[model samples]
Target: MATFRREKCTINITGTNRAVRIAGASGGFSDRQRAISSLARLDVDIIVGDWLSECTMTLHGAQKMENEKLRAEGRLMEQPAGLFDPTFIENLSPALPDIARKSIKVAVNAGACDAKLLARTVENEVKRRGLDLKVAYVEGDEVTDVVNRLIKGGEKFTSLMTGKDLKDWEYTPIYAQCYLGGAGIAEALKNGADIVVCGRVADAAPAVGAGMWWHDWNRDKDFDAIAGGLICGHLIECSAYVTGGYFFGFKRLMDGCANLGFPIAELFADGHCAINKEPDTGGKVSIGTVASQLLYEIQGPLYYGSDVTANIEGVVMTEEGNDLGMTAIGGYQAEFHVYICGLDLEAKAEWVEKQIRHSAGDAAKELSCSKFSLNGYCPDNPRNQDVATCDLRIFVQTKNKKLVDKSTLDVPGFNRWCMDNGLQGCPGWTLGNDQRQSEGKIYYEYYVSLLPQSEVQHRVVFPWLGGNTLDVKPCANMKVYPRDQPSYETSNPVNLKSFGPTTRGPMGWVVGGRSGDKASDANVGFISLLTIPKIQYLLDEEYKGGKIERFEIPGIRAVHFLLRDHLDRGFNSTSTYDTLGKNVCEYLRSKWVDIPNKFLARGRF
Candidate 1:
């Protein structure tokens, strides 16, 4: 048996991006013996290879699209090779070193095809080639869907199922690899596979995979190993996320960028890994950046993976220097993963943009307001409101009646109030039809549900790097969603802001003359302040056949209140009485404005 140790590893290799002799602190395998030989040189036990990523799939899609386009244009291309899975397998074949071929375990987390397919392919190859290649299979699509579903729906929902469900879900069309982690791979290792090829496993999976092998961990075993693996995984998950992709103030450090390198996890049996990278790379390692990356895509305090609940709180990264940092992480509670289903629907129709105009109230100046009431003073008898020239709006949307209806409901009544009250031309209201709705407009929305891994089948046919494989074929399944009348509306800020005659009062409370905070309801208490002023104003104007009532800001044009309502009131109160100025400003500032910006330039209305 070969021995494994925790130490830095150096190997003679060519650079993929730059020409330099870079020593790796950890080792992983492509070819079995090559991996073992590298391990021998490094004296380490495990090696990890990153296979699948969304970015990679997107690149593949783009290439496929280009090939089809060219073929259709009569620009024929050469045939493509049938060396997809073969190349990867052949790459690993050299690992049959004299020391111990069986002892060298291999794993593949790249999912270009189904787990069963990859498993069967490798099995047949090993049998035919007479190589005792022990391999483990991890499904990538499964893990991605599991996490994605959990994020969209909570754990309270019973949408997920067990891994055994794959048997029944083998026929689904998978777009991407469903990811699994170390648990299954570890199980395969214990089951005597010298190598594991997974459909869609996570980048963090290798640590968990190796940990599972070393500890014989079950799904519910000591989660510390899993958690340790998670920490290691977090560091390496993005390949360079921890190194410098999202590094804070990264532009300030020279070593911070020019040559972004991938992360390496020098993992230990204790489940910890010293996060390092290729030497001479252009990036720095520090506590702040690593800590930030650890928090990327995090879920609950109880971090859930397909295999276990990684306790994130226990993981800690400390800064050593500009290019050095230390991570101390452990402790985990195991949790079983849930399987989930998702929809894959295409839009039946789409709405495009069109131009049109409709008239409402002629101008913003048509509005007028008094203490007790408001009037638009329009020349035409305006919509039943006591106000004369109150603003009106004509809204429209794409032919979709449903979306248009919803949009109208969402139109803020506050803008109408401002327009009716002649608060138009308020500093920030710039859109000409600002809040106006149009008629005879159409709209279309596009939506697609990302399917779960079990619902999709991936068939990865890898060709030689920079080499052609198969001849391009025209896609018979090209979908083209036709565009028609755009359902968009021009804003009518003037009329939209002046919906109703009366202004809607701000919501708050008022206390009695001597009422203490505990004794009074602040909301209703506010009714008194406006009520008193309204009554005085009405009475002074002489009960002209109508009741002396305080008018709340009109629901239609509440926006003016949003702009000048509080400002004017506080100004009036402060000017009326110095003692009340501070209290009124303080109160309004606290009660209103959710995301307040002291400076006008800092925030938008």
Candidate 2:
């Protein structure tokens, strides 16, 4: 655990650590409406949800830009509605009485561009329904003006993907929303707010704030417990993800996906918690499902949020499953991942790039970006065929609609162009049969960076206090928190033969994995390195064969991998079917590999 310092100000730690159960009712803007009413009926103290997502940022940002243009031209028709998620109002309308009846507290970041507006709306609804819920909202996430000032001061706000500076960006930024943390949300909840609304807090902030308010956890003194809340928030933030919604082992789901149950976290005051769901709900809670979200969209082992940073390297999950099938449009992309075994890794990766470029011909200029990555490491003296392979991915993004115009192209557009050199690919070359990824579509190149918490005017307002507002202080390290943390990298290889007798099979047959695209890179994560686990055993079993990075968390018996540039430009800009890369783990699971016979005997399935 790491220690974080606070400023000279004192924070009141009033509440004792007691058991608190919170239900995850929504994952994002379009989550099922049934989730709210359904979870509200459960025996939970608080209901938290995540409505903000990366694309929603793009959507709202783009909408703001468009509306500005319309206003300038006098083409604006009044003002735009639903800048915030209207779905929140719709979902909460039916769940309000249940919430009030149970005296359940609620928190959510459903406010997209405007938290005050959404909060007021919720307040009005409460009053209209003759309910007694006190509603408040956290503001100050919209930092476009602050960002502009910083730009003038020479702050680059460089892209995490490319080193391109914000000033050098092609599109004018409509707004720069800094991700606020739980402090503001906690302040509101603690100050008698029954329903807390927020705008642009991190997805996990709702839960973190609820936990902070309930347990009076000091952000600095109780760093580890706060970190536990951060991790817990991450687990159920996406609603049913930790309860088998997107489990890699969906086929093993005892209860089918129909009406899958949302997850509930029984968080203790000290931050230890067990994740469960409503009885007889369509999903199941187990170590496998929980581990998937622990790996989703994380950049590294130390997960940093606006309020606190969580160290997830040693995080663990257990099956205690008292239950649970479980079970996006964008720029078109025609792409494929190729697996090649044996030497000349980079050389062969380059060879594939050249061939694709040659095939792309003049249309290459129309491409927004194209990336070729040689992923996965092969083990020397590999025991199985899969261990000797590397994934050479050809990822391309283009906004030019003409490139995909069927009237002018043959062989169904770019897919054929990328496949033109299939015969000349790397040694022992094998490619996914799917050829739809070659198509390109319009998508925002997802960019993420940090904004100083000190610059955020985090505040909370209570509707009952005649619209009273209170400013919440930023974290102590806000002034000095680095924009970038240490990057996680892997090294020191081991041969597959070290794992004993092997059988040829898919790693998913015995293991569980979860992957998501921050729209898909080679591997999406931040900083970490650890002892190599069996994922390195089955997925990267070859000794020094490929460069696929693998990570281990001994507590949970799990290994994670990072696949660089696997998806061209991710969901917003990709034309691939696996836009969000939710299927990446499943794809890896389906790939045949040499598995240790011993472990296979005790597999999850």
Candidate 3:
């Protein structure tokens, strides 16, 4: 509860080889309490907290708008305070004195969309306790007006995921934010600020900014070092993620990992970093743990950031001893996903494709569609056979963004045409989810793409320092490259009849899997409970020439399949049934796969 008197101070560092140890306190709002504890216990120069995710921003924005509406209607007293993460003040209040006493700087993106307001809240809290913590925030990421102006000027504001213009969207976006880099945070620290809050920055921006401030790294001349810091930021950006929290081998670390410690990175001037956690805290930090995190949600090998692109293709992972994990950094056109449902009983996938082609014309030139039959109509019990209607789901893919958008926009017309031909269709011409089917859902998939660093505006606002702002620019030495696609191999011919007596059951019976969206692509990684050869045989016979491509990570006992052009440009803009790719694995699991009786006899399935 102690507080320090306010003092104006400037941070001046004069060391090239000095190393900075920064801790990632919170991954998101849920980790508030634990994150605060890390600041109290860990010996670090700075603590970086990340509380903003894409979903959190949207939800928080909606809540703020709702509160404003209620206020206008006289539903409450004065407007509620703190539009940023609600728990930010609660978590940081108690630790302010300790942070001040220890002379440690704090940088976080807990501000979400309202950095200035969040900064004011933090400033108020500090003053309430008689503390003089200089709080600063970075702005300019809020691009609603910028977007509107661009749209007015006839700029498409094309989606990076779907490559479609936002002009075609039926509804205007609530807000459009650009992902900023770490230069702003670094600038804030340089100008005597103790705490830096930001809005919608790249997840690792804080770490990168802290590195820049600590080392005085030149933005133009230090591309390698900056890239290195960017990598470090990514490693610990999710707190416990680098410390065995979400490792594929979670079971092995379960005993002590329940209270997993947040991650800290000891970053060198050269950009190399070592990740660890507070002493006596739970969770393991090893090669596997770090590698798992490094690969999480990544698209192609090249990891793009607002400041630098880290090539991870040749990154080496090795163990220093028993507990530490190390990695060496190094350095695509993607596809969109279309989900079609509620087909008439007589409707065939080929017919649906023809109709789509006709509606789309040249737009559907290179597009490919894959059909899936939902044999049962009952959402409550998918296995029930007594349902009156079933659904035909089609997944369409192409590199053409306009074609995808047009196909989606033309769904109503397609449905009308189908209903008109119902009499000529099959005997049991029925459809489910009539309303949703009539309004076709299309998603523009996300893929890793690059933009010039010069285009990004990075700036810091010093609220405590009379609201002055400093601008930061991207490195002049940086080079941008297009993302590469994953190379796929054709499935080896397999004679399923050669395998002994088989049981036709859901694929999940023999395989446990996980699926997620990487930009626009859907990555489904599954482990075989049975032998690899048998699983290979099943995949070869079942998934050949499908939109998915199968590959293996030899280090882990798992097979992963990348569903190219899946998820319709990713979660943000995807209108697909499964926007997050969360259902891909479950749906595949529900599909019947012929399993060898030998494995079933062991009861493993």
- Please report the candidate that would top TM-score against the real structure: 2
RMSD of 3: 11.8
Score residue 111 of candidate 3 by CA lDDT: 91
Best model number under lDDT: 2
Q: Give the TM-score of candidate 1.
A: 0.38
- How many clashing residue pairs appear in each of the predictions shown? 92, 54, 12
Per-residue lDDT of 188-295 in model 1, one digit per residue for the tens? 666565666665455566666766676554444455655666566655555555566544335545554755554555544455556655455566555534543554
Q: Residue 587: error of model 1 in Å?
A: 32
Pick by lDDT: 1 or 2, better one: 2
Over 483-529, each residue of candidate 3 has an lDDT whose tens digit, in order, gives 34354432454566787889988776665555666556666656643
- Write candidate 2's Cα lDDT for 398-476 as tens digits: 5445663332123355666666787877666777766554444344545554455556688888878998889977554
TM values, all candidates: 0.38, 0.74, 0.64
Taken over the whole model, the C-alpha lDDT of each candidate is: 0.35, 0.68, 0.62
List residue ranges in candidate 1 displaced over 4 A: 1-43, 53-105, 116-133, 138-179, 252-258, 315-605
Lowest-sum lDDT 10-residue window in model 3: 323-332
TM-score of 3: 0.64
